[model samples]
Every structure is written in structure tokens, then in C-alpha cells.
Target: MSILMHVCTLVIKILVLPLQVAELLGLYQLYKRVFPVFIYNISFSYNSKMNDKKRELFRELLRFSPRAGPLRLLEVGCGSGANFQHYPSGCRITCTDPNPHFKEYLQKNMDKSDHLVYEKFVVAPGEDLRAVEDNSVDVVVCTLVLCSVSNAPKVIQEAKRVLRPGGAFFFLEHVVDEPSTWTYFFQHVFQPFMYYLGDGCEITRATWKHIEAAGFSDLKLLHFQAPLVFLIRPHISGYAVK
Candidate 1:
């Protein structure tokens, strides 16, 4: 049994080396070209467990706000425009992502959705969204984003700054696992590789804590586990009013 265990561990270690090499070569962007499709497939299964919770939360918030004109949505790190299908009809959307490779995917997704008015795709990080005007957006949507940003707080601040009064900030993010657990320990242990392979994602970010500290009114949140059994399973989803 001991010899078999050792062999299994060795095989796992060998498998990780190629991934590490890819990271060192900065091929993550290229990797992401196809990775987004894989993620969407997994997400279709995984997110169904949550009953389309993020989309539900977003729609519920939108109902409360006046829809005098086409509701303006600013999505930070809107990778491949996955959330575009979830939005209501006749809405204006500005999708931002740092990866230029995503432009083709974003356009493809946008073409599928007749309801969304494609504003533009900006190549910018979440921490700085100067291209978006202050007090202009009706809602700011961020999902699976905060973990990978260079600065989480600045992203929150930028989100706040862009939202019009009574505008909503909806986020769904995988947070750090509880302390003293094996999962938490391993998250930290493999954090460097996680950052490299995940495009700067920190598996152990206490992002929900930062959201609470951002000073939003009516800050409602839901803490839940994803269907997957991984260090990034502990997640928070909800909205805060600006």
C-alpha cells in the first residue's frame, strides 16, 4: 500500500511540472483562448446546482430600480461575455477584460444575444476603470473576478465610483476556505502556482470581508458552497446598493 501511494504521488508531481512550465513561459493567455470554453461547460453544470443564483440575484435587484431608459451595465472582467445571456432585453452593456484574446469570444457571445446593446470592450484591469464615466452605470456586475485582480479594494472603489445613486453592485466570488482546515493549508501551499496558472488568482482571498468593509448600503450577501470539492468552493453571492 505504501509503495502504491508513493507511485501515485510521484505521478501527480510529474503531471504538475508541465503546467508550471507553461506558467513560467507566460502561456496562460494563450491557454485561456480555449480555457474559457471549458470553463463555460463546467460552469453550466456547477452553477445549475446554485439554481442560476447570480442571474437571479441580478434580476431581483434590477426590478427595484427604475428602468426609465435602457439599463446601463458595467461588467468588470467580463470574460468571454458569459453573463450577457442572463441580462434582460434592451440593456446597454460595457464589458471589460484585460485579455485581448477574449475580444473574438466576446464578440461571438454578443452576436448570440440580441437583447444586449454592445457598448465596447475595454482592455483594462479591474482595479482601474477610468474609461467608464463616474455615476453613469445603472449596475456593476462582477462574477468570479475579485480573486484574480491585482487589487481587490481598488476594484470595489472603482465599482462604487462608476455606479449611479441607488445602483447595484452584484458579485459572485470564490473566497478563502475556513482557517485551520487542510483545504486552507493547501490553498496557501500551492498559492504561487495557483497565481501563475490562474492568471494571478489568489485561492485564499478573504474577499467577502473586503466587500463588507467597502461601505455599501443595504449590503446583503449569501454565503454558500459550490458543488465542487475544492479549496475555492467557499463562495459569496449577493448585491450591495451604492
Candidate 2:
């Protein structure tokens, strides 16, 4: 890499490292209080590698999401607007995230026109969603968000409630893995730390079951593993028709 690039990378790492360290230590409230003040956008220094990884996973999701085109899309925790670029034409997007922190990033990276807007970046917890029209959305895309929500079941219900008939709910998430013994062990060990560091993400909750229980049909398991690591990629990416 060139000197300027190297220096920039070093600077970003320098800026983010403290928060990363704090997050891993289970000091989430502390991280939350300080993170917005320090680390505003996580993907500031986008490169081909990051873009390629994003495309691969995102493409994988689109391939699995049933009838993606011309759908009214709702992304619950859209961050940095990375997924906005890949939406098929005719798909109108409305993103609701709990962070107005990335408005500039979204404008620069994803907003191509007036049609797409981040209606409300930050919102009060689940009950606040009562305003979203019921059965109006054709698709609800949520990835890596359920892990952190205060109430996963409520969100799943909301996603289901807002989905149009024949609509699909797409998920690409890092969830608690199975093989009874390991799953149990992971629940016991990781729950406390993960809850704090990972945005109150629950490592043990059965999100699949929750989604299924919400009366959505056609559950498909795209992938899963016992331990979820970036390198290991123990992610579950799939969709269920609403």
C-alpha cells in the first residue's frame, strides 16, 4: 500500500481500537456512551476487499430472498446504507435504524435519488413501530440486527405484521449455533459478554424458532455453524415467505 493509505488505515485503527477493546470487555453501556462520540462510521475506509465481501454476502442474500424485484423493502437496522445500492429496480426502500450518526455516509454512499430516504435514523424501541402500516411492505430485510435488539420476538412479529401477503423476510445473521452440547455450552459462556459488547446481542436465543413461530412459512437454512467468527463465518443467511 501507498504511504498515505497506510497512514490512513493506521489512523482509523488508532481511532477505533479503544472502543473495540472496550466492547470486548463487556462494557457496552460505556461503549455506547463513548462510541457515537468517537467512532461515527465503521466503514469509513471502504476498499475493494470490503466491497467484495459485502457484494458476496449481499448477492447471496438476494439470490435467496424470494422475488426481490419491485418489492417495497424495509430494512430494520440499515447501517451505512450498504444494502441500498444492491436493491433491484422497482424496489422502494425505507430504512429504520437506531443511529442518525451515519446520515452523511448514507448520502455519499447509497442515496442515488429522492426516492430512497432514511426516514428516521434512530427510534424508540419496538412499540414505537406501531405506526408502520401493517401488511404494507413487500419485504423486510434484517441482518445481524436481531442479535442486539431488546426484544427479538417483538421485532420478528413486527416484521411479520408489516409484510405483505407473499412477501418474504430475509435474514443474514450471526446466531447461536447448535449440536446440542456445544449450543448449551455457548449459551452459558458467551451470553453475558456478548450481551454487552455486541449491542445486547443474545448468543443463545432461537431466532429461527421465533421467526417460525410468528406464522411465516417456508423456512430455509442457508448456512449455520457451531461457533460464529468472522473468519469462521458461522452465519445464517436465508428467507421465509411472509
Candidate 3:
């Protein structure tokens, strides 16, 4: 058993060496930029199989009216622009991300989204979205973002602040699992290292609690387990109207 543990530790050290070197050389930014493509390819591929079910449940929330001329959307993290193809026609999206490296990936996704208008990309954090005005956008979309923000409440407030009165905040996030579960135990034990491995992602964030406290009306949410994404298995997804 001791020999097996030593082997596991050695493997971990070997795996982490590249990450340590990237941080030391200030190439972590470049890593963060290129990393999402691989992750999104996996995640989106899995989720695409369920897109028909999702559309049946939440298509109305994502769709906009062409009669209204144009609808504005504010995507908080917008990493690698994974959600661009999901937007309705005539929607103009302003994507914001702290990592400037995502600019290239986002632009490429924008080019593919022929239905949605590519507004612009802002290099900013979700916690401070001063670039957007109050109650201006029709929707605020946050996917797999709140768990990584330093202050989730502040980011939620910012999402609320920028949304028009009747507009909604749509989110898809991974959260900590329920207590006493084996997955929860592993998630808790490995949480600290998740920041480094997942680019500041918190495996145990009570994101649903923060969203509930944001004072949004007509709140609706769903909690489910995703066993595929090893580090981020517990997930919550839904929308809240402001």
C-alpha cells in the first residue's frame, strides 16, 4: 500500500510539472487561452447530444423576438465563446472575459455564429462590468463562470445590475455535491488544488445560494449530477428574471 501511494504521488508530481513551469515562466495566460478549446470540445460534444432536451425545456428563455428588431446579450465569462451558436437569431452579444487570450477563440466562434450579430469582446472581469450600462441588456448569460470568480455575489449583483427589468440571468454552473456522497468527499478533498488545475475554479462553491440571494424574481433552477466531468460533476442550471 505504501509503495502504491508513493507511485501515485510521483505521478501527480510529474503531471503538475508543466503547470508549475508555465506559472514560473508567466505562460499561464497562454495556457488558459488554449486550454478551453480542448475542454469545450469535450463538454460541448457531450451536451450537444442533450441539446434537443434542453431546447424543449429552455428554448423560450434563449430565443428573442425578431419583431423587437434586435436583442442585446451580455455573456459574463464567454470562454472560447462556447454558447455563441446557442443564441437566437438577431441577438447581439457583448462577451466579457478576464483572460485576453480568449479574444482569438471568441472571434472564431463569432464568425461561425451567422445568425447572431457579433458585437464586441471586452477584456474585463465579471465582478466589475463597468463597460456595460445599467438595465441595458436583454439577457445576461453566465455559463461555468460563477465558480471561478473571486466574489460570486458581486458578480451576481453585476449581472442583475446590467439586466433590463424584465430580462433574465441564465446560468449553467457546477457546484459542490450533497454531503455524505463519495463524489462530494473527493470534491472536498481535492478542492484546494482545483484553483491551480482549473484556473481558479472552486469545486465547492454554493453558487445556487448566491443566486437565490441576488433578489431576482421568478427564479427557476435544476440540480443534477454529471459523472463525466470528473472534477465538476455536480451542476445546477436555470434562469432568474430581474
Candidate 4:
């Protein structure tokens, strides 16, 4: 197990080295902007697979959106439309993002898929989502997105406003691990560069605390981890029943 762990660590460092290098050079924004397109292109190649762990992280929330309520859903930061395939039956899935590229690119790519439910694609930021109507959506979903938003707290508040009573909010995010020494150290050391380059992501944030402040209760975390090697905080993904 120790040998395998070392091997995994080595592989991760090697793979992430380019990003680290780019981060050093202040080209992280360039990297972040293009990474989505690269992912879009690569996702089509069956050999370039979704890592099982990432799939598991997304699976729980994606699978839940279908059953949350009978109304509709609004997904904030629908990157590359990656979560589009998981919409529940008989539900309306409306997605929004500030990236204009994502607006057309995601639509063109995902439009061909035969869906089990109704879906709509829109271009808007979270704060302005009030145009969608109050208490109309059955659920608000955020996937790997809270980390990159300009105003995550405001977005969460808007999500609350748009959701109907007894509805649910689901999110899957990478967050800070308070318990791990290495995690805290790296986050402090690298967060400035990461923020500038990775679209305002905060490695030291209390994402769960923010969620609670967003007025969500009855929270249930399906999965979470805080081991060394820079925590991924997958437990950030869970349901907040309204």
C-alpha cells in the first residue's frame, strides 16, 4: 500500500507539474480558460475517460436532481454542460453560466444527445438569476462551481430565492480541509496564485459554512475526505433540503 501510494503521488505531481509551472508564470487564467475546451474535446474520446472517483463525486448529486421535486431545476456554472446527461425524468433543467463560450459551445455539443426530460440552456450569472422567477425551481444545483464564482455567497442566496419551499439544493465542490496540516499549508502557500489563475477559487474557504449561511438546513453529506496530499473535499457535495 505504501509503494502504491508513493506511485500515485508521483504520478499526480508529474501530471500537475505543468499546471504548477504555468501557475508560477502567471498564466493560470490562460490555462483555466482553455482547460474547458480541452476537456470538451477530450471527453468525446472514449479512451480519455472520466476518472472513477470524479464520476462518483458527481454521480450522487446528478442522480439526485431527478428526484428532488416535480418542478424544475436551475444549475449554476454549468461548465461544458458536463452534468447535462444526468437530468431527471419529467424535470425541466435550466443551466446558466457567465462564459459566453460555454453558452454556444455547450449547446452545440449537448444538443445531439437524446434526453429523458426537458432542458433549457441560458447565459447568465448567479446574482442575476432572479429573472428566472422566485420559488419556481424545484432545486438549484451547483457542481464543482462554488470555488470559481466571483460571489459564491450571493449566488447561494439567489439560489435560495429561486427555489420553492420544500425543494432541495445540491452541490459538489472541492473545499478546504481544516484538519490536515499539509492541506492547510499548501492552501496558504499556493492560494494567491490559484486565485489569480484559477478564476477566483479559494483553497482556504469554509464552503460548508457558507452553504449553511445560505439558508440551507437538513444538510446531508454523502461523501467527504480530508487526508493529506491536498484535500479534494468531496463531501462538499450533498443536499440541502429547503
lDDT, candidate 1, 31-124, per-residue tens: 7677666555555665566556756776765653455787888999988777777788888899998877778777888999998799999999
What is candidate 2's CA lDDT for residue 130?
68
Q: Which stretches of candidate 2 lie over 4 Å from their true place?
A: 1-30, 33-70, 102-104, 112-127, 179-188, 225-232
User: Which residue segments of model 1 deviate by more than 4 Å?
Assistant: 1-43
lDDT of 4 at 27: 77
* lDDT of model 4, residue 159: 85
What pairs collide in candidate 2?
147-201
Best by lDDT: 1
- Predicted candidate 4 versus true structure: per-residue lDDT over 1-242, tens digit per residue: 44544555566556567777777888765655676676567545521233443455435544334344444778888767666655544556788887666665577646654553436767788777956888877778887678877788988888888887876788777777654456655555566556654566676676778887776757776446623234443346677877
TM-scores of the candidates in the order shown:
0.83, 0.66, 0.83, 0.70
Q: On TM-score, who's better, 2 or 4?
A: 4
Compared with the true structure, what per-residue lDDT tens digits does model 2 show for residues 1-242? 24543455456556656666776787645555543433235434432324444455456434433453445678887655656665665456777766565455556555464445444454434424665789887778887678778888888888888887777788776665553454445453545545555556676666676776777777755565523343223556667876
Q: Model 3 shows how many backbone clashes?
A: 0
Clashing residue pairs in candidate 4, if any? 223-235, 224-235
TM-score of model 3 relative to the true fold? 0.83
Worst 10 residues of 3 by lDDT: 57-66
Q: What is the lDDT of residue 148 in candidate 4?
A: 75
